[model samples]
Target: MKDIILNFGPPEELETKRILEVRSLSYLERLERLMAIIEVSHTLNTAKIIQTKKR
Candidate 1:
């Protein structure tokens, strides 16, 4: 059996305009960095599940 996770949230497009409006030194840059971290975490989680099932 497989388990699925659901993510209910707003889309990234909403951040597009807001991100562009941010100044160079603003916290929005950190937001983008955090987004990258989130993506990496998701990839690692998926890889771990696949590796576990193969054992």
Candidate 2:
């Protein structure tokens, strides 16, 4: 079974923690994540455009 960790903190604190975690990643890891984000964004935009044209 996988381990589950829980965090209890304010939004600002959580955001800071997340930022720090991302910063800790290597350049290649960060680039891969950014590319995945861009791919998802492009897919969603294409779907929206197709749906709009079908209306």
Candidate 3:
């Protein structure tokens, strides 16, 4: 779980807290996917901040 999720909080939203089973993914594969998601999220946040600064 540590490799997949950087931060966890109390369940409030069903979509964020939903559980899924991925039986085929190796530990490394899961980490890679998590990293990809983190990168994408970071990129999106940066873009949003830049747009705000431009205003």
Which candidate has the highest TM-score of all? Answer: 2
Pitting candidate 1 against candidate 3, the one with the higher lDDT is 3
**How many residue pairs clash in each candidate at the backbone level?**
0, 0, 0
Off by over 4 Å in 3: 1-21
Q: State in Å the error of residue 25, model 2.
A: 0.3
User: Compared with the true structure, what per-residue lDDT tens digits does model 2 show for residues 3-26?
Assistant: 856778999998898899789998
TM-score of each: 0.50, 0.79, 0.60
Cα RMSD, model 1:
10.2
TM-score, candidate 3, is 0.60
lDDT by residue (tens digit), candidate 1, 1-55:
2284554556675465446645444587679767999999999999999999999
Model 2, residue pairs in steric clash: none
Tell how far residue 17 is off in model 3, in angstroms: 17
Relative to the unseen true structure, what is the C-alpha lDDT of residue 26 in candidate 1, on a scale of 0 to 100?
Answer: 53
Query: How high is the CA lDDT of each candidate model?
Result: 0.72, 0.90, 0.74
**Candidate 3 residues 1-55, lDDT tens each?**
4466544666654345444444456898779889999999999999999999999
Better of 1 and 3 by TM-score: 3
* Candidate that would win on lDDT: 2
